[model samples]
Target: MTGTGLDDERAYLRECRAAIRRMAEGARLNVVIGERVAGDRYSAERLGYDLRSLAKELDEQPDGPPFFGRLDFGPGSAEHHGQRYYIGRRHVSGGPGRAPMVIDWRAPVSATFYRASARDPRGVSVRRRFGWSREPVALTGFEDEHLEAGQDLGVASRIVAAEIERPRVGPMRDIVATIQPEQDELVRAGLEGSICVQGAPGTGKTAVGLHRAAYLLYTHRQRLARGGVLILGPNQAFLGYVSAVLPALGEVDVEQTTVDRLLARGPLQGDDGEAAAAVKHDVRMAEVLRRALYRRVTAPPGPITVPDGSYRWRVGQEEFGAIVTAALREATPYGVGRERVLSRIVAVLLRRAEARGRSASAAWRRGMTRALSAHVDAVWPATQPEEVLAELLGDPASLAGAADGILTPGEQSAILWARPPRSFRSARWSAADAVLLDEVSGLLERPRGYGHIVVDEAQDLSAMQCRAVARRSEHGSITVLGDLAQGTTPWAARGWREHLSHLGKPEAELIALTTGFRVPAAVVTLANRLLEVLTVDVPRTRSFRADGRLRIRETSDLGPATVAAVRDALGHEGSIALIAADATLGPLAATLRAEGIEVATLDDIASAARVTAVPAAMAKGLEYDHVVVAEPAEIVEAEPRGLNRLYVVLTRAVSRLDVLHTRPLPAWLAPPAGVQG
Candidate 1:
């Protein structure tokens, strides 16, 4: 390309930026005018909210380009004949009488930009990719692939490589400009379809999931907005890491939360063994809870009597017991059945009055129903989730009744509290208990469902947890995202089929993304060695960028070596993470701080320090530019499926990785010095 060509592209970029500014300004004015012309208080309030949301969407990001690629179409195309279209994150139009200055990447016409190639032009004549600096305000360079005959398409795009290799800073950014053909297929997948992405580490599965959410919002805005879209991550740290991606794509309404937060019950206190927690999280626990809850509906202790004005209605113990038994046989939830039982008792009294030649008014029946409430309350009480779960864990008789033929005596005892608390308020609940409470809460009352849910790190969710998440989206669809190889929990899913069935999305289409764009080739290659030991058969991922450097250091003084590694990593341009075993994170963070190094723990959400000390377990869905692993052996020994955890720790690096270990690396990871595995 010559100077004239460069100048022409620069001028076109400037023109496009001006158009975007005008479009944003016009949108702001429309919202302001709408707010002023509101007819009532409700309309005004709604207009204000819409205005705030529009302002967020139209807000200019200083470090982001309005458009990334431009396509020139030949004559006789479906839309825009012999016209040029700029594909960008958000749509921008020229004033009223002019054509659109930029087309949204999610638009049908712009699909050619991402899908077209020399092999298949798809009506596109030329594709141009503009390169920008980190700030993305000015066009630094341009690359064009001409599809006309006798014209070279040029070598592979340096701009694409540069964008993929961009240094990591802050949270993950939108991959709008650099979305691969495979990723675009998933992103453009219809809103009604549920896709389960089984991607290897660094394969950009999380990004693909978020982008799909944004795309569906764009395509089915009103439907999804009414039902709502939710993104479920593993923890707060992971949620905070990817929170910015959707906003950057002009989608601000998608809810991003964790399973525990979404369940919204209990403080996650108390403890349970792995075996006990697994048993509680089993799908069979749903039936056990059902038995425990309905057990509260026993036969009436005595006859019921009600007084209305000068008349009294009496129901014998046998009749009342028969009514309760019939109501319980309805198989409805306890809360719902209790009301039916009470209504039936009132009906029996009303029928008796009619048979004796006495008339009962509507008001008289209402009065009788209220007067009989005390007897019904004593027989079939209204129970809360926490109250029932507490009884199930504390009382031996209730446990045995609910667990009979379902759980062994040892398994039942494992879940029972050694010293039962007096009440629900005094009881401590663990993470697993929160899931059980969610299950019971759903049974008592129908849970509200979202329009769509994106479950990230889904393999780590237990069967009960999946049920809880599925209940919230029972009427909608789901996007399940995770790699089985990265599963670290005891109840991690062995297969996507079993997992999706628990999520109530058994027919969801499964998509595998085997090409990695985040982690470098060398890092993923080293991590893939663990696949030999693990039973999972994940495909080897291909990296887009050059191989990153991997250095292994041997040191007797672990603290000093880790600190030195952190200092060395700080010299890089992007974020640095020092990963160690959970037990070692506290002391290692303290040691780093004591050495005058500013370090932030992963749990500290408020801190944005460049150097963060992350535990191996919490580092599942996160990535950093430079990573320092303190000890490989400790991470492998941390849990039963520790090899999976170590694989996750090793692949977190995007630019470089330094492995500092005082102890010998696990034999599976590090073979004999002279012999290669």
Candidate 2:
């Protein structure tokens, strides 16, 4: 009914499937790539099997519609520089033994027939009988998001109106829990524009996002392999938490990465010596500042109050003026502390600028700031004044020394840093892809590339962090998932809805998962009081038990309190996790274990063990039977930063939860029925 004739369609399908088979075989052969095969002729000798045999086997499949196989190699080939090669195949996830080297595979559908329909079969009459068609018609316009979704739903999935649906594909209600009728409808609403999902805790933001990704893959199968999809998570720990969810929905393994790793490896690793030196110097400067700030020196008000109250500090005008005067006067016969002054002055000025607004143009700000800094060296001790430069000059020696942590000695020696490389090493780029940074919000400073950026904690990301992610996307699609009310990141300021207007974000769709999946209705009561802080709808239900498990205690020592909580969980044969605000808490965990409480540290729990406890933030996507929230009181302060951490901890528990504290709970932590023990 669809094509010219039955024989013609069959013949056409045969040829198309044959080509796919040939491609698959070629991919499986593992012909040495790179310069060896980059431009070399693909003669029969280079190929392991006869093209005719490979094509014939694919055409002999008994299925109603043939399947397709897809493979990819590292950057090298003349065609795509790490391109995907497709062929019709019978199975997906072919065992490691069957096809150890192959990348991925999918089944064939209407698109395959349509694209192959036009080509001349030559002696292969099946293709000639069907007649000729250019590319796969159905898959032409679909983006990466659509293609990935389509694949998950099924190779036969299609786009009806804007939504991608596969009637044949089964729903994942068992693993995913209840399916919100609204969620299915939301994903199907497929607008040509972008959609931002505004959700609350346990609202299935992640579930919906993944379903959409699968729908896209299934509906747009042809381009799905190439359309890179990126998922950006909160941090490395969170990245690992949700890594397997995509495969569960039948979508391709979307390349996952964090914004920080992207920036560090992408553009930050400069091409030339000068660029490398500049980057290295900036890194050193940042490190030095971090160390000094850790010292927490409380000096007198020398004209300007030291900037505080945020991530970065700002210097005052008075302090700036004083430093320059001293540098100049000290430069007289005796050498002046110009270098120290330069560092201190720059630090103070940046701190002040970061705090409050300065009445000046961007250019004027840079000029004035640079002028003041430069003058310090000019009026100093020696006859020849030292020069103060605002930006670091990328010097190779300095870069080599600075790169000790990131690069190996052999790598440093092999790659010439005197000047930029005309052609970048494919290995370097490929190697850099391994480290995934989920707390993408932390690395919002600049852009690099995220094959596909899926922002898991959207509401927890600030405007600056969003902008940073936008810059990082080189040629991939971005997927963001979050509930605005669940925001606990210091950087997440404005509402998640504001992201559209602020970032000029693409057409975003709003999907509300009305059902609460993680917590029971009784447990929901505690978080309901804090729901006032969020703008999204958070329905309460008695889904989980309110075991009078939450307790606030006032103990003189946090260590003993943590020990007591651990002892309590272990007494019940329950797994216990002790979490702190940051890595600084690493020591706290160690000290507690020293007290002979069966405590688990972050590193110990992060591995393969299932019954282990982790920090609230680190435990973002993970769920446990018994969660002992350590230092909830410390995180419950009215301070914006503290509130975010507190929120993160409160929402982490699944069935049983205990809030341990060294002091009385903060009023901010208490909701309607938050009991004190």
C-alpha lDDT of all candidate models, in order:
0.84, 0.44
What is the C-alpha local distance difference test score of candidate 1? 0.84
Q: Which model scores highest in TM-score?
A: 1
Can you list the residue pairs that collide in candidate 1?
none
Q: What's the true lDDT of residue 137 in model 2?
A: 27
lDDT of 1 by residue, 305-364 (tens): 777657777899999999989877877767788898889988898889989888889987
Show where candidate 2 strays beyond 4 Å: 1-178, 186-193, 248-252, 265-453, 471-478, 533-561, 568-575, 582-588, 595-598, 605-619, 637-639, 668-676
Measured by lDDT, the strongest candidate is 1
TM-score of each: 0.91, 0.47
Q: Give the clash count for each candidate.
A: 0, 72
Give the Å shift of residue 464 in candidate 1.
Answer: 0.6
